[model samples]
Target: MTVTQILAAPAAHTAGTAGPVRGRRRALRRALWGAQILIAAFLLFASALPKFAGQADAVETFTRIGWGQWFRYVTGTVEAAGAIGLVVPRLAGFAATALIGLLGGAVLTHLLVLDAAWALFPAALAAVCALVGWDRRAETRDLLRSVAGLPRR
Candidate 1:
């Protein structure tokens, strides 16, 4: 075969690889985003559950946080809303924003007030948010463009 023929062969093969590479990237992106959503939902359920209703340790921990019953209700409500946003196609960008804020606050509370070793939950959540947000940047940007200046509900 000629030298030009060999060079052309690699270019053709690379072109073929492009589609598969893009597919894999897309799959990973979806997985990361789904994981973040699931984690948020789990946190919501755990934080909202009644103290001592099921587990003794959970009850003690809830009491230790000292957020009070009313605060628990508020956290649960917002978490539920965040979870809903995660699953809804139209609300992905909003969900990502909310999750980041929620996790950021958790980390701060742990460092400033709780001062507990178990504050890693929020830190991990924040990492997941960063990953999902990074993967979905283009999509989120398009969403923002679509919303333009619409008033929030």
Candidate 2:
């Protein structure tokens, strides 16, 4: 009936048994975040590092793609950046979205230029990135809006 009561209604409604559900949701989110970080780290070390170092396999792969060694460094840099961004809470979704593109390129390279069998790894990584980005859609939207200098809703 009162202005104060009206304004406080929503908070009051959440002040009771909603605690357990909220706790569970928080736990689930934490678990998913942990998994996301682990995957990003794995990609950083397993794939990105070798590319940056110009390891034989990476050089050969890039050569097969007809892009030369320079492109290896570029892809490695992007992957490294994305991996770092993945650990930052505000940047996770954006990073995952970027990684999706990078990994998609890998997939295309495998399918078009290299052996199709080699495409599996990048395809899986891309799928995981897609899931991460979808799960953090709100964060992605916020980051995009901020980058575009648009007013937030």
Candidate 3:
């Protein structure tokens, strides 16, 4: 092949591949957002609301935990905040990381204090949060650096 044609070949190939790569990234981003929304809704409506409203099952469960009704409120608030954070672009990574810890505690509580079967839900949620956290690690790092008064890496 001519020198000019050889030089142009890689550029053409790269340009051809770029469109598909960009499309795949966009699709993946949309899927992640969709998952985040669904999980956030579940946390807010199914988990947090019951605690805030003092639903019978929630009260009974917290009573069994021996942490008092006050602890229920605290847990509810955290869940609600995390749910809100998940939808906020800047806070999504941090929120997911926080939720992973919260969900980890939940998994332990279910295994130890509640039914072992109940641990599965939180474990699944934690896995999703881990995905989001991994995807947004760069943003998380930037946020932490800003909080620490360190310049961006």
Candidate 4:
């Protein structure tokens, strides 16, 4: 075969390999991230609804949560947003960033101004974010690479 044909053969083989490579990468990434997404979803649901009925500190809970019924709206929205964001290959890496930031602020609020018990909520979510960040370091690295405008170095 001609040199052109020889070069074309490798390109053609790579084109074929691309499909399986991407698929495996996607599955790996998804598996790593699925747990984090579930955690986010669960947190959103709980935060959206105060499960403890008629607890002694009902008013205090609402007050410390800092949004009353609006807390439901805000937490639900952010949690769901983060949940959805976790799936986007481009955004999943930083999904942990925004979420963990929120969780960190939450932990601080609990320590400083709210019930100590409330700290668990944010701490749990923060753990999820950290796990996601760690497991999907490659994806997060990809995200930061783009954000920093550097090549895939």
Strongest candidate by TM-score: 3
- Each candidate: RMSD: 9.2, 7.8, 8.2, 10.6
How many clashing residue pairs are found in candidate 1?
Answer: 0
- Per-residue lDDT of candidate 4, residues 38-147 (tens digit): 76566545543343333335456656666675554565567677766776667775787778987897788788877679799779878767756655566677678988
- Cα deviation of 14 in candidate 4 (Å)? 21
Q: List the candidates ranked by lDDT, beginning with the highest.
A: 3, 2, 4, 1
Error of 4 at 138 (Å): 2.2
Candidate 4 or 3, higher lDDT: 3
TM-scores of the candidates in the order shown: 0.65, 0.79, 0.85, 0.56
Alpha carbon lDDT at 15, candidate 3: 50
Q: How accurate is candidate 4 locally (lDDT)?
A: 0.63
The lowest-lDDT stretch of 10 consecutive residues in candidate 2 is: 3-12
Model 3 Cα lDDT, one tens digit per residue, 61-116: 99999989999999999999999999998889899999999999999999999999
Taking all chains together, the TM-score of candidate 2 against the true structure is 0.79
lDDT of 2 by residue, 31-141 (tens): 668878887788799889999887899899888888678998998889889989888988998898889999899898888989899899889878777767766767778
Candidate achieving higher lDDT, 1 or 4 = 4
Alpha-carbon lDDT of model 1: 0.62
Question: Taking the candidates one at a time, how many backbone clashes does each contain?
Answer: 0, 0, 0, 0
Query: What Cα-based lDDT does every candidate model obtain?
Result: 0.62, 0.78, 0.86, 0.63
**If ranked by TM-score, best first, what sequence of candidates would result?**
3, 2, 1, 4
List model 1 lDDT by residue over 4-76, tens digit each. Answer: 2322333325445656544555456567767866865676566544432445654455466787655555665
Candidate 3 vs candidate 4, TM-score winner: 3
